[model samples]
Target: MSAKVQWFAKDLLIIGAGFAAAMHIGKLPAAIPILQAELGLSLVQSGLLLSCIQCAGICFALLIGSYVSKLGLKRCVLLGLSLLTLASICAGLTQSVLSLFSMRIIEGFGFLLVTLSGPALIRELAPIQSLPAKMGLWAAYMGGGVGIALITAPMLIQSWSWSVVWFSYALITLSFLIGIAWFIPNTTPSSQAVPLKSLIKLTLQHQPAWLLALIFGTYAGQWFASVGFLPTIYEQNHIAPTLAGLLTASVSIANAVGTFICGLLLQRGLQAKLLVILGFVVLIACALLFYTAKDSLPFMLQYVLVFGFSLFGGLVAGSIFAQALHFAPSPMAISTTVGMILQCSALSQFLLPPSIALLVSSTGTWLWVGVLMSVLSILGIVLTQRLFAIQPKTSA
Candidate 1:
């Protein structure tokens, strides 16, 4: 294919896969609670169900990067999506905790394949000029996927069993798998992959890559911290639990709006670093508005906090991922570069939000968490600026 044609085709293909992944992840909250209640699972067990997937994703990051030639991005994605579809169905039908745990591991492995290779393929197909613009669009799609999933999960659960929600999400994966199998080209390398240790060393040494990871981790931590408390805050203030879930869906979908807007901005010639800094600013504003205005404001404006928080939040999420991958041009090491950043980001996503909740308990308020977000977000902006100033052109 011509470079131009390949760029368009590859991006569409990647976005399609992202759409499927987003739907499944978005549905997690509604569906998991059912399984938890049904199985009488402890809090730790419930967390592991999610972490099991993260763990699988971690291992697949290295294995996929280290073996893309043998497995091929197309094959891996299709295989993973197929497994995801099956796993979703199996997860719905699981009769016991053990069976559910086994199914979650399968879902984890499948998700890892799809997530790691999707961006690597985009990096391969993008022309040098399109890096910033194309990446923005890619990020928008990921954020969009999250919105669609979260919004739909509640509606599905209201009318149908949570099991049906999983099965329905499976249909999304199945459709994506079929589309990918037919349209997306095989993207495996012909040569053996770089050694795992060497790939790690290369990415760790790449300043821009590591910086992007920190930026991603920082904003992701802040965003997750806000989002984690959003539902509970609403509930504590007397909003119905179901209403809180819907509110979560609203904020999540708003994140998609933020992503699409940022992507369009990048396409229109905005600088990536400027956008990253702007996102941090938005997050800080969101934090202050939510935390500082207890009774002064009317109910409606204060309630809009969720939308405001997620409104421009995704600008940070997708930009950093794209930037991290763009810092390296080697197809041989692209997987490792993306993997390392994602792994770090995933850690923050898992750890930081809970820590903030603990702060609320120990400190007797959400003030410390709010302060932590502001400080970290500021640091992220600083790092983004430094990286941009040092490596302006190539580190898109």
Candidate 2:
């Protein structure tokens, strides 16, 4: 019982740290207006700023995963949090766009390190029987972080600048770092002798890794492309900033709830492939209903559809996280599998958001947004089906 409690505590600590890292990602959307006013950024530039954290994930997922394997998960997590704390504090003082850009890249590296290590660490600590449930809960960390950040920023920025919010978040990360150090035991890597090339090759060779990574990319890209712009969209629609923040936060919270539900479903023997397919289908339907002819639709209905998009869309993440644990090529390859998924997810985030912005800029309406997302969702569904067909007949 004591061991189980210790594992549960460790899982919570890792999830908390991940939530804080995600807040660093989430903070930019809330501050877009302030950033535009201060730095004279264009819409596309703001999109780039919002996805700046993906830079590190795109460039270094495999590299960082290899490092985590060598350095030990606990050490890597500590190092990552330290990077976040320092970069966030420095970002609070930056006056130049170039400086802020640099800080964001550093922050990206920090985010990558913590997130990449988190799941593998949880798997290390938790009992095998509890892994599916634990991973499902772990999957909600990013959504919860984003939701909390969106809700809080409007209130914080009313009395203080976005920079002070950055500073305050740094303090938050520092507190998590201290708690993490005290609670989570330092576990050694499974093997120190494997070469990076071998790990990458092994990860790539795993059938489920490719499917999960691609699914994660598609779901994340579509989700972020929509949610990341919600604040700006609501602002343009003449909603109050606080209200927009509240609305966006509510949608994000729905996503977190979806992931939690997915976890429970997985524990109840819900097939992973079915969850992925269902999530994609729901996202497509919701995207169409939410974004089609936006000006003519009932405002309440549009909000409800967007909320549905987030809620059902969350099942994709929970399913992928739970399935990946079972599908990792080996115990040593779990971090590498996660890193690959994150790599693809980040690539989509970096590419899709800018593409979405361009689409809106050229078309002069969000109507086409649904069209784009529908195509992606269809592709996601096709890929998921292919993934299911290729798996062993007895496998979930």
Candidate 3:
């Protein structure tokens, strides 16, 4: 194979690994009802199940990101996939809530390592000019993996069982683990170990990184809150499981499209700030319309609104991921900066779903979900404005 073809192949393998990792997340929503029925879980517990995959990232992403370079990127990626494969298998065998929850947290640790390392490895492989577009594609890993899992898990669960779904994901992830280990060359940069204090200080002091993290956090929180519980929401509304999975999957795939478009647009010299602001504006509109008008609007229209919300939210995420490469305080701090971003994003994902569940549980309605989304979108907009003010260069 030509060198170019080799690089492209490696990129696909890396992104595919991300997709497999995300399946562990997407597989759960469709299974929530099954879990609740079989495991005797309450609404609060279900919410925790949905968000717990982020627990590792919320607590340790920055720390792990800082040290991954020392550990070797390929090694981390392999180890992460191995953990995921093991966790999925163990989760499948678990007959109780506690064991399943423990496996999910282990899955979270695997997820954090793979995600924190993937982008930096991509940076090492891709040419400078194509970085934005590549990052955009990289950003789509979440939506793509989650979307496919959302659609497929329902069918698999219906035909077989949730354990089958978990085992199937384990097999898929294991295949990727082997592929990555065999095909991807070790691309870890040769660099002296930076002191932990210096890495933390440099990454923390980078103002743009923090703003970007907050922006990503706000967007991720609302997007996950809306999409993660979609299966349960549809169940309550008397929608068929298959149809609900399709709708939720479509919304997530739309998000993947938005992220890809953001990449192409950034490569074409569009401003990151403009794309981010546009995302927030549209998100606010969609959230308000979808949640408030849920009872009155046609189901198709409601789906369209949420689809738009996810799609535009992707733009915000893509922009942030692309910009993170540029905003790192130094070359050595890039992984740390990305870690900080994921850390904040994980924190939001960790907090928002359960909070929304609590609100919905107390109120006996989904009406206030929109209000909460709108508030977050507005915060996103304010943060975007401040981010651009501090670093006003238009080009990505």
Model 3 weakest lDDT span, ten residues long: 387-396
Model 2 local distance difference test score? 0.84
- Residue pairs in candidate 3 whose N, alpha carbon or C atoms collide under 3 angstroms: none
- Summed backbone clashes in each candidate are 0, 0, 0
TM-score for each prediction? 0.89, 0.92, 0.92
C-alpha local distance difference test of each model: 0.71, 0.84, 0.86
RMSD per candidate (Å) reads 2.9, 2.5, 2.5
Poorest lDDT segment (10 consecutive residues) of candidate 1: 387-396
Candidate 3 lDDT over 268-341, as tens digits, reads 99999999999999999998888887878876687788889899999998999888877777666677888999
Which segments of candidate 2 are over 4 A away from where they belong? 36-47, 232-236, 360-367, 390-396
Q: Candidate 2, 252: how far from true, in Å?
A: 1.5
Give model 2's TM-score versus the native structure.
Answer: 0.92
Q: Give the candidate number with the greatest lDDT.
A: 3
Q: List the residue pairs that clash in candidate 1.
A: none
lDDT for model 3 comes to 0.86
lDDT of 2 at 220: 92
| Model 1 segments more than 4 A misplaced | 1-10, 57-64, 126-133, 190-193, 241-243, 294-299, 392-396
